[model samples]
Target: MNLELPLAELTALLLASVRAAAWLVVSPPFNSRTIPSALKALLSVAIALPVVPTLVGKVPQLDTAEMVVSLAEQVVLGAALGFLTSLLFSAVQAAGNLIDLFGGFSVAFAFDPLDASGSTGNGVFGRFYNVTAITLLFATGAHQLVLRGFTMSYKALPLDGAMSLHNLQHLLTNGLVEMFMAALQIAGPLIAVLFCADIGLGLLSRVAPALNAFALGFPVKILLTLGGAGLAMTMLPQAVSTVVDKAVTAVMQAIGS
Candidate 1:
């Protein structure tokens, strides 16, 4: 038995595999630091193999210019999908930052291992909440939904078609705004409580000139912030659930449209 591929067929498969691997490197679950890069590449190749078969005879034979153009398109599609998944995590981090700012922990800074960027001191709870949300995302099969979206994207945005500039602009604008809005919603309750506490402290300081506002306000604010954080934990499940649902919906809409 002999098995050999023609030059044209080989080139097409290679192109498809490269495109798939590029997307996987930047997308979630597969893109995590915890996952080995080699494994992610391997999985991308595995997925691309089947997909390429469907396109092998259908897609045009590649020339140098065409190959370059197609490769660029694939890179854009992959990066966009990966960025969409990452937005959820970004929203979580932004919410944590807001909580820290309002909770009087802005001065307390710590490095987040996941972000590698400096996070707030009050972020311990926020980080824990993020982990829980990510866990639930996987446990509830939301990760599978993401994978399905990626697969469907090939059909919707075939390599031969021109990328839609309008769709790209809409996604960029709406996706970013939605992430920030979600973060604000998650942090709103705690921020409101902290605002009220500041007003109360202001009233107390005016009433008693001799009392050291600095000494009295610090402990009181810390206690109130801690209590608010504890209460916020009770709302985590519902908030996370809503966020994940929205993310999945956005991915589907992006790919489908």
Candidate 2:
């Protein structure tokens, strides 16, 4: 056997793998540093396997400047989709970050390499929320939805579809607004409670200037936060499901669908 057919097949598979792997590089749960590079590469190949057969006659020639431009476009497309997915997913973490802000946990910063951008102290609620969101992503099959949305891009977007700037701007603007809205929805109740606590502490300080209200405020807020966290648990899975669904939609929109 000359291995000629096998070589062409491998080439196609590798090209498809580029898009898949590039997507995972910035998409959450997959983008985590805890997962080894080797594992990510394997996962990329695994995901691309199904797409490879469908890509017949569509692989671009590697010998021209046009091909280089096309490959660059593919990378950009994958990165854009991945980033949009991640932005929505971060809503959960944003809620948690909000909690940290008022819970007096802001000063407890530590390094978390898995976090793409954030201080250590900023993740108190964010870390817990992220872990729960990731769990829900798998348990509720949202991960599958996200992957399907991405895989479907081969048809909806095509290897050579021209990107529309207006569509890209529209998706990004809407996505940012949605992200902050989700964050506030998740964290607002707790923030309101904390605000009440602060007001109460302020009144107490006025009534008893001898007492250290500032010192008492910290423990009281911590207790409230812990309690609020338990109450928030019931809302987490559902909120995560909604966010993941929106992420899939955003990914589709990112590809101009």
Candidate 3:
């Protein structure tokens, strides 16, 4: 079968593909190191095809100056969307870090295989949380919600539409704040339990000066934290769902879709 398109149409398609690939390479679930680059590119192209028709007719004709500007705009837009989607993972990781901190695992560090980056204190927990969230994201079909957000972007911010720096900045700021809030909520229970435990340990030390507080408190706190984490695992699915929903909403709103 012969498949061909006019030069102009081809250029538009290529441009859209570039934008999609840029976003997919950085976004969660799609951007994971485990997913092959070839598969990621293929997925990006598949995503761009449905939206290409709507954009081709409206996007300006390819010219040196216009091409440069449009390409830059597309890259920026893709980055913005990718960054927004990544916040959910960041929130999960942050929660894990908080748990580690309050649980007295601050000195335990581990190399995260998924990120290929070093982590400190509760870094291992953070990485585990992120992986769990990503798994849940796929299981719940939240990835489709992310793709839908991308499609809606076309209507909110067309291919040739002007980029609103003010709006983008606002969205980015709001996303960061929300990420922090989500992390705090997920870690709150563990932190509260640990706090009370610490106070009780301090009182015990004051009461019995002969007792070696460091020797006994360490093991007790570790056990309590592990138990607390086990209990908290029940909430992981709900937290993952909420984070994905918030991320999708943020992306859609960022582009004013």
Candidate 4:
């Protein structure tokens, strides 16, 4: 028995894998440090498998220079798609950061080993929210939906399509706006209470100088934040779902799908 492999399909699969590899390197929860790079590489190839047939016909002639250029394009395209997706999902972590800022927890910054960025300056709530969001993504099977969205990108962008910088810029700007707004929505009520608490403490300080209201402020705000965070956690499942949908939408829009 002899086995035959079509060169065009092989080239297409390799190109598709390159794109998926770049995306996996940048997107979460696949991008988390807990996931080994080797696993990511395998997963990328797996992800590109279904798209291979669609891409085979689109595969351009691959001389050395064209191959290099094509490989670079795939990386950029995949990274841009992943970045847009990540930007939408970052809203949850951003909300936690805002909570930490308002709740006086920012002072206790420590390293989050699970974070892809390997940043050592995240506060307690920020890391908590990020971890929880990732867990929810897997538990609810939203990661599959995210993968489905990426696979759909080939139809819109294709292997030979050139990405539009102007459109990418527009989507990027909108993603940022949406990210900030989403973060505010999640942390807003808590922030408002904290703000009121601050104002009350200021008033109390002015009225009764003998009693250091500022001293009480820390404990009071901490209690409120804890309570608020507990309540806010109940909303995470829904928020994660919404973010997943938004992430998919952002990816499709980025590729003009």
Q: Which has the greatest lDDT? A: 4
Better of 2 and 3 by TM-score: 2
Tens-digit lDDT track of model 4 for 56-141: 88898879988899999999999998998999999999999999999999867644455546455678999899999999999989
Ranking the candidates on lDDT from highest down gives 4, 2, 3, 1
Error of 4 at 167 (Å): 1.5
> Candidate 4 — what's its lDDT?
0.91
lDDT of 3 by residue, 1-257 (tens): 99775866676677777778888887887888888999988987887777777777767666789888888888888877888788655888899888878876655564445434443335556767878888888888988888887767766777787557787788789888988998888889888988998898888889996897757888988898888888887888988888888888888778876
What clash count does candidate 4 reach? Answer: 0
Error of 3 at 246 (Å): 1.5
lDDT string for model 2 (1-257, tens) is 55556544565677667778898999986898878999989998998787777675676665678667767777787777888888888899999989988887765555456554553445578778888889888788788999998888877766656567688778888989999999999999999999999999999999997898999999999999999988988999889989888988877776656
Which residue pairs clash in candidate 2? 109-121, 110-120
Cα lDDT of all candidates, in order? 0.70, 0.82, 0.79, 0.91
What is the TM-score (0 to 1) of candidate 2?
0.91
**lDDT of model 4 at position 209:** 82
RMSD of 3: 2.8
Segments of candidate 2 deviating more than 4 angstroms = 6-8, 110-121
Ranking by TM-score: 4, 2, 3, 1
Candidates in order, TM-scores: namely: 0.81, 0.91, 0.89, 0.93
Query: What's the C-alpha lDDT at position 252 in model 2?
Result: 78
Cα lDDT, model 1, residue 19: 62
lDDT of 2 at 61: 64
